[model samples]
Target chain A: MGGTAEAAGGAGAPARRRQARGQKRIEEILRAAAEVFGEQGYDATTTNAIAARAGISPGSLYQFFANKDDVARALAERYAARLATLRAELDTVARDGRDLDELVAAVLDPLVAFNLAHPGFKALFARTDMPAGLREAVAPVHAAIHGRVAELVGQLLPGRPADEVARVATVSIQLVRGMIPLITGAAGEREREVMTGELHVVVVSYLRRQTAGAGEPGRA
Target chain B: MGGTAEAAGGAGAPARRRQARGQKRIEEILRAAAEVFGEQGYDATTTNAIAARAGISPGSLYQFFANKDDVARALAERYAARLATLRAELDTVARDGRDLDELVAAVLDPLVAFNLAHPGFKALFARTDMPAGLREAVAPVHAAIHGRVAELVGQLLPGRPADEVARVATVSIQLVRGMIPLITGAAGEREREVMTGELHVVVVSYLRRQTAGAGEPGRA
Candidate 1:
């Protein structure tokens, strides 16, 4: 893998060594940034503290980041990219030619998986102190994720307008996203199951209605 | 009217008058706390900063609050009580035998109105860093809201299981709450309208399906 090769290069090689050192430093800074930002929060998190956590001098930190805001923005870009990757996986699921229930699960499962896999990233994104530039930068990826889900819903309901499908898609996504805290145990296990099971039923019922229409012949 | 006079009794009058004065200070502190926490954010805001914003001495602030955490918890309790009041209004609406659409509107309108009326409080509650005590305390209100909506949905479709009705209720509420940011201009007007119309259509269609099922001989 690229990551393994890059790590093996280390800082003693040559020209690539300099690049690797720079990249490694940035990674170290980002790890520290996430910890500090998660614990003390974004606005309270300082560049100096990030530097200290990374065991780097403030000047070295400044060489990579203009300020704390810069580091946060960089972190957001990385997070957006990661989300984009997960969104792509969701797109794959959407195209799996499954039934409506499977389709809905396809769209939601990756999100749940991503949140479980990298909770710190989710925590960082959840913080309200995120910079405007970072938010704006992240918008397109979020929009792309939404657009892909909407497109999948449209596929499942061939008769529905794209816009209409997008609407239902947005609402369905909203339903699951709202359950994040519960799904992740912030709301406790019993509450999580209650919410998740409820969401499952609602998604299925809503999708069935959208596809079957009101009082469609022979419909349950 | 009596509240105003009782609140005014907090003015420095005498030793006996200290009680009202202390109460007024706490109220002032809480108001200041909400505004600061809303505007500057929870973690970024400081107790001294809130005291200054309240136009009170730090000592006076301390007299009413042990720390910013205490003030925030108090403010959260106050906001939770306001939400409860709003829920009471929704309960009345649910009991009034209104049409399905009207019942849905009744539940949502008050919540929207409350957010508009107390943007500061809304912002504070929306923050992810809210104390665990505050989050746990609000869970019952959320459950009650879900339960009331479930009952109304059952009334609207007389034969659905109480659990199914509750699931639909939770989905609907989550749909609205999730889009609050979008509806309030965080996601732009066109997006808001499309989402609102889509959710309206979904709800209507789903309810129609349930009602139709009731008319079928030997069907759910």
Candidate 2:
């Protein structure tokens, strides 16, 4: 599907140049939109401010998006696509037969990489007012990654139910998400490494028990 | 510090009346501020809007707060105080004799209850721009609760390190905080029960792990 767009662009030089320019303009608009939304929030952010930041006119913005909401949806879609690529890349990095520590590291490293690479975009993606479709689209990818982590937990602790495994997986992911902004800021390098190491030990010890047959009783 | 304020107010009837009125006005301002801040956000929400919401002139708003930042700080302080009270209540209700599930419920239930009772306050509390002092005040209370939960986890799983247990406790608390807003409407009853029940299950299961041997290998 992406290949078709590239192929069509290659067929006509002038058309391709115009298309490339439009794409660049859209990217610029999205970048400006993310900053505005992050700083001022979704409802208060205006198309005019976004246009001013992008060094474009409102009419140019309208040519690409219907309005602010449309721009938000588009931005969210782009972010979700980026996250999907990261998820796939992380999956491709084989976890089989690795220690649980390494498997957990594999699951978390790509996410940290994404956060470091796109801190502003990460903040925007975490915003509450994100479009419903974007939330729906990202939910399954989250669930799939969580499922894989749960399977790893299951292997480490074969006595636990699949549900319990998944619950721990979800908690681990939520913690990392909470820590992203904190880790990125003035906590210092040593602080982040310590927090990460602490989190690792937490997961390992929690899992070791169910495999040992002394697991706490789970809620029905 | 609190005793000093109480002593000052206790010295005379006029002082007591003035203090009561001042506290009432502050509450009104906070209520108005929450609505404005939630609707318009921190950067865009105006002191005038907050004053108007409270049926007062902009000058009257300045009597209590120096500016919008002061107003935000006051709101955050009130919220942190409320959260502290809620944590205290949870600690009072929780008994060590209770099983892990009950213990978890006792720890989380009061927080959910407070949010259910004050939905607007919950929304305001969730806002990222909460004042630094308020955040700092909440941290020790959070740490206290986290430490208590960590001790419980250690009891349930005898061999886990205190540091590791504390990390899981922190993770669980963070999860509950993030999940509450997603699953509950600003103040709706139906969503409240659903969110609480969902949280109950997650906490119960996450604590009950599969691999429990001392210094067990990290491999799944």
Candidate 3:
């Protein structure tokens, strides 16, 4: 057994190097796919385009993904994971006892950054014609975000019913979701900044009205 | 010339009748297309299904539209015209001396009814993958609504700059647009009503904040 283990380790070292290379290629392909999808949208994009952008042969691209839908599904999974991380960070922020304005900024600023960094995420997620597998991959992340927002909402409006809290949270999330396209599609950086500020005002204002007189005395 | 006119009238009679029948068939096909598009979304819907739903043969359906895109474009034109009419009505409502609550209700209620009556409108309008021609057809109505809303914002905030008013109006319109799916996709009619009311609260709250100290002396 000792002799067999020693022999296997020599092969395992090269195998591990190959695995690392494969993983790096996969990441490169995904990053390239994201950019192409973000620029052209889902339907207009093709695997060839992604391969070209990634500087890989079509055969190499095919080795990693079956088709464009497969690539989109992988991208959706990537976005879901990133969103989960963001939500976890937001959970931490929510527990920090920030005021409502602080909370709004904490939540939205990271979200805007995430959206900017991952422009393809919205391109895929926002598609009405998205394949069911891709939608399934994205849906839970959305629900998790909604759940987290509802928890925060419940905290803010302590005496409110669960349903009302959930409703408000849903509306709040939708409001942010709706503004994303506008913010991302802004004509210039100045326009984007102004729209972002407007979003903060819209969200913070609605939340204040909803949570008015409901916050802890000191918090209010 | 007299004999030519009489001869033309005789041939034109059946041509006119055929034209009327063609128009009626087109409307039925459009009505059916709208329902199918709403139920199954654009990608899943096929011309055969639309023809079947409209109680026409595929051959008959082809007489009016070239393909699904053509059908969708026609439907878009129809929606654009209806939305224009709705906008004119909204313009009348804006001119009336209604308070903000009444104004919001006036705007949203009819819009909700329009969405309900034509579920396919939101289906097509909300799609990120919508075809360019269809999008162009819908874009003007959206812009007109935005323009009208911006005008109202300008009135409410009399001294505010055009850009700020435009931004507020864009956000306000987006807030309402964001809620349409939630309101329409609610689990039940009761939930729908609750979501609709919540939407009203959200829009009203945000607008009130934007317009709070800006309304005219008597208006405030």
Candidate 4:
């Protein structure tokens, strides 16, 4: 987020201020859209609902986006931006000498929580019916996340080829991607806890095997 | 699939014959629905297309199914039936006393392939847009699969609570559920191969840990 926000260098002051305001307004609309879309789901949520949630006039909403799909596209772009920042942060964490388990927890906690917190994401990407373009728009962000995770895994298990670590990273991410919903979708607190704990075992156990005879503590 | 298929004994002979024909027609229609749905996807697929694929008139199609959703429901039923067969076969494998890795390879290979082979499933369940009922219809089958997997895990790791094994099984299954798409949706064969191998690393690694010190060969 640091330096991610940049003002136009050559633009006149007024135009620059107006552009900043435009960007802020767009961000608000996307946030509101995410909330509404998450709660009511894509099919039930409407532009008016988003505008209402965003505390903007319908006209103001139109100034930024023409319809719900447009808002969704904008949201995907915002998610990508956030993901880029997350990746940068993750890169720094990997570079630091933090314990790999702690580093993984630091990175994955917020990452998966991002899904649980934003119902709109599950509604959009999880659903089979959202426009393919919306999922496609965000693919790069997912890929970027995967790439960063692979880098971190490679750093931890230094002896392994980058390629092997990458495959392991993809498996880990995909396993979590599949498991998160089942956890979130669990019938009760106990069930959610059980699933989460088991998932931790699944991931950690897999990693220990991959890093066995090589990296870090906690190996048998 | 034996006793599951039966003509009413009390009914007149002609009526019984008609019922059998009706059942056969339904199966054909569902198979055709799967092909069309797999190829074109859920939303893009039409009832007419399904009917044509099944080689029946619109009226004949309607006699069995009210609409596309009905076809999807029936397809889910068929999928469940197939899974039940799979579970039974897996149960035998579990009881037959084989190497755990070999057993796992035998079970998971076809199970994952089932998803890749059936594009209609990806079209239906994979879609963010599919109706809740559609997802719900298949939930029991998934649960059943989880239950069977857990049972097998418990058999391998005797003395552990069935519940814990079941939970681990759920994690493994969910992990596979999540990985298959990434594998099938992989950009190229090479990427897919890498992902598949890593997933093998993941599941086997986790299982080895779960059953560690309790069961199987090569335990050190």
What is the alpha-carbon lDDT of model 3 when measured against the actual structure? 0.74
Q: For model 1, which pairs clash?
A: B10-B20, B10-B21
Q: What does DockQ come to for candidate 4?
A: 0.34
The TM-score obtained for chain B by all candidates, in the order given, is 0.65, 0.68, 0.78, 0.71
Ranked candidates, highest DockQ first: 4, 3, 1, 2
All candidates' TM-scores?
0.66, 0.61, 0.81, 0.77
Q: How far out, in Å, is residue A213 in model 4? A: 7.5
> Which candidate gets the maximum TM-score versus the true structure?
3
Compared with the true structure, what per-residue lDDT tens digits does model 3 show for residues B1-220? 0001112234443322247777788889989989998888776688899999999999998776656666776787788777777767777778887788888888889888888889888767766445565676567556767787888777677888787788778788778777888888889997887788878878887888776763421111
Evaluate model 1 with DockQ and give the value: 0.22
Best by DockQ: 4
Q: Runs in model 1 with CA error above 4 Å?
A: A1-18, A32-60, A83-97, A126-173, A186-220, B1-29, B46-60, B96-100, B129-176, B186-220
Off by over 4 Å in 3: A1-18, A57-59, A66-70, A87-89, A127-129, A213-220, B1-18, B57-59, B66-69, B87-89, B213-220
Off by over 4 Å in 2: A1-19, A28-72, A87-106, A129-176, A194-220, B1-23, B34-49, B86-97, B127-172, B186-194, B201-220
iRMSD computed for candidate 4: 7.5
Clashing pairs in 4: A127-B127, A127-B128, A127-B129, A128-B127, A128-B128, A128-B129, A129-B128, A129-B129
| Native contacts retained by candidate 4 | 0.47
Tens digits of lDDT, candidate 1, A166-204:
766766666555556446643565655555554555566
Q: Which tens-of-lDDT digit does each residue in B136-218 have in candidate 4?
A: 65565556666777777788888876666676776777667666677677799777666666666677777877766634211
- Residues A8-81 of candidate 4 have per-residue lDDT tens digits of 24454243234787778877888888888777767667788888998988888877664555567567666666
> For all the models shown, what interface RMSD does each have?
7.9, 5.9, 7.5, 7.5
Give per-residue lDDT, candidate 4, residue A124.
Answer: 57
